[model samples]
Target chain A: MTTRERTDVRRLPEKQVRDVAVLHAILDGALQAAVGFQVDGQPFVLPMACAREGDDLLLHGSTGSRLMRTLAAGAPVCVSVTHLDGLVYARSAFESSMRYRSATILGTAVLVPDDEKLHALEVLTEHLLPGRWAELRAPRAKELAATSVLRVALEEWSVKVSDGFPDDPDEDLDEPVWAGVVPMRVSYDDPVDAPDLAPDRPVPPHVRALLDRS
Target chain B: MTTRERTDVRRLPEKQVRDVAVLHAILDGALQAAVGFQVDGQPFVLPMACAREGDDLLLHGSTGSRLMRTLAAGAPVCVSVTHLDGLVYARSAFESSMRYRSATILGTAVLVPDDEKLHALEVLTEHLLPGRWAELRAPRAKELAATSVLRVALEEWSVKVSDGFPDDPDEDLDEPVWAGVVPMRVSYDDPVDAPDLAPDRPVPPHVRALLDRS
Candidate 1:
């Protein structure tokens, strides 16, 4: 675990450095994250498809992206992942809240070295579609040249989680209010096989497995 | 609409602004959002239940919060909402991307005046669980005093969205690759009625409707 200062403790109350397993679970659960940073004194945030590769996160963009260029210049960046578990219906409107788990990482991003970019790309690819990497063609040199990838180390981070029932106000507990949780989840629907897919080419096992869980 | 200067786009790309409707839809559809800001040179991000109230977003926090104070003091802030539409499987590992719609609002948040706090709270409650304000007990004076609500005007905002198929490199298009979209959605499970509820007290129609859609 990495040790870094967490300056704002009130909004971000839980500052415990999460273990690697916890961090991985949070990253794996959310397929996308909001990446926030300041470019020329203006705050800019862009959501990108991301995957965790060892101790860093792989974020990709077109080579001409201003976001990529700003990050490459060693500007500070913040990446946030959130999962809404349930809606907390409290006895009073003021006490209503959501049960959720979120992780925020603040760090400087470095452009991935060419030698390691391919592997990072593979991590992202497999993360998006398991078993598809081996079936797909590799990137040509020029195509790879046109893309830029950055790895932001997850060093200074915090995870704030709120779970279970709503914290109803004492006076409103017996006010004839119906209060409970409405569970929220993310799930996949049946895959729509590609229109161009050959009739004989069956859907791959990895893709089929997702539907089975549903 | 409130014509605040912060809502005015300074360096915003014209093409991106034309897609503003898509951004509004993304924010409306997102179940959760990460609110980010800096306090004394340190960064913090918190996942909060949010709702769009007119042209602004309503975010609730504890009245005694250090973060709310920082925000009310005119510190820079970023609120981001994202919906992961699908996982885009591509012909090459480098071309794999996720179909998503995201909006980031950059501005300083203003604390909702005490007189207007109740209306803001109602907007949040109604947004999370429709008809919840009427179903549940209203906040007492002290409870209302104990909570703080702020609104971040969505004036200076940008929405980035990508949908449909992956933009894979041309050379990899026919390489025996299975490329398509794995659609994702956020859903609500059946609401759990409170254990102490009276048998005659039926679940409200608003709550019951979300069950079948789940």
Candidate 2:
């Protein structure tokens, strides 16, 4: 999806903005994100396992979570996703930096309607477990009542990014220092089976497929 | 180093403040984070590639970035680090959720003094590239002058985390749905050598060692 077109005086310059494409990449690649907000002048950030549902982000919390209650009051919020691409080492300390992609969305969240909540949940499930949704049982009424689901539109956002090698001072370029980017990434390692699983139960096909891909 | 004493918050009872030890784990393990602040009246949250530098967080930007300039103005700022620990697949769609750990710090920043800037740079260097700082050239006067370094104390912060599997409704627990956590992590693959490097130049010991540790 495209980022918001509007610009503000405080916005990062075009070059920095262009780097924002990395932000989208981080969000699109992950299964979850951390959502931030200000409550009573105090800041609160919660890491919610999330899924991008269509043009909106679907987040679920316990029914009585303070974050959920705050959003229910229509408070403005910020959702951010970031992926650390690499560490840039320059000839000099001033030029050392990181290559990263991050996206921040600033907007108010609305509770998902009863009818749409199920779909959002499905999207979240698939995003996390891939094939588990079809195999799992659906939520009952009481369970639905105990959960709080939020849908935030991905408008009014900006992405800022930095990449490439360090930009050393001209004079120090010849300094006998090694310089380059050391990359980093998020990965899924071997899975640990649940302690309570039945002895004869084999790894499910979906889980096996995901592990194999990794 | 420990997270600030007053900045830790607990997830149980859902709102009490905890200790820094708990907060430290969240900050240390988060996969990504969004750094937020205001320039003039507009809000900006840039996802940061970060690592803890003692009790302070080391954030790097362009030599003359808007973010650095604004932060140098002494306005209050918020930095958040988050990791999506797992996806909580419950019996029902509404019960589906994610487990995560996140830390948020809110405070004013001080432009690190010139005398201490070098030390700050070392903290960042070691955090990002480990042993590369000794291998790289130090910053020259002009290069150091051109860069901005700001330090925000970890006071007035809070970390909220959730782990384990989804808490499905009692009635739905019997519903033949699969439930569990799909764990996540940050990993590194094989390193790619720079094309400009002399063909005979071997990978440095420090760089090569990161593969085993990172």
DockQ of every model listed?
0.48, 0.38
Extract clashing residue pairs from model 2.
A20-A159, A23-A102, A138-B92, A139-B92
DockQ of 1: 0.48
Best by DockQ: 1
- TM-score per candidate, chains pooled: 0.88, 0.82
Query: What shift in Å separates residue A214 of candidate 2 from its native position after superposition?
Result: 2.6
lDDT for each candidate structure: 0.72, 0.64
Best by lDDT: 1
Q: For each candidate, report what fraction of the true interface contacts it reproduces.
A: 0.53, 0.34
For every candidate, C-alpha RMSD to the true structure in Å: 3.9, 4.5
RMSD of model 1 against the true structure: 3.9
| True-vs-predicted CA distance for residue B42, candidate 1, Å | 4.3
- Judged by lDDT against the true structure, how good is candidate 2? 0.64
Per-residue accuracy of model 1 over A13-105 as CA lDDT, tens digit each: 553435667777888876677777774445556666688987888887766776788789888888888888888777777667777777788
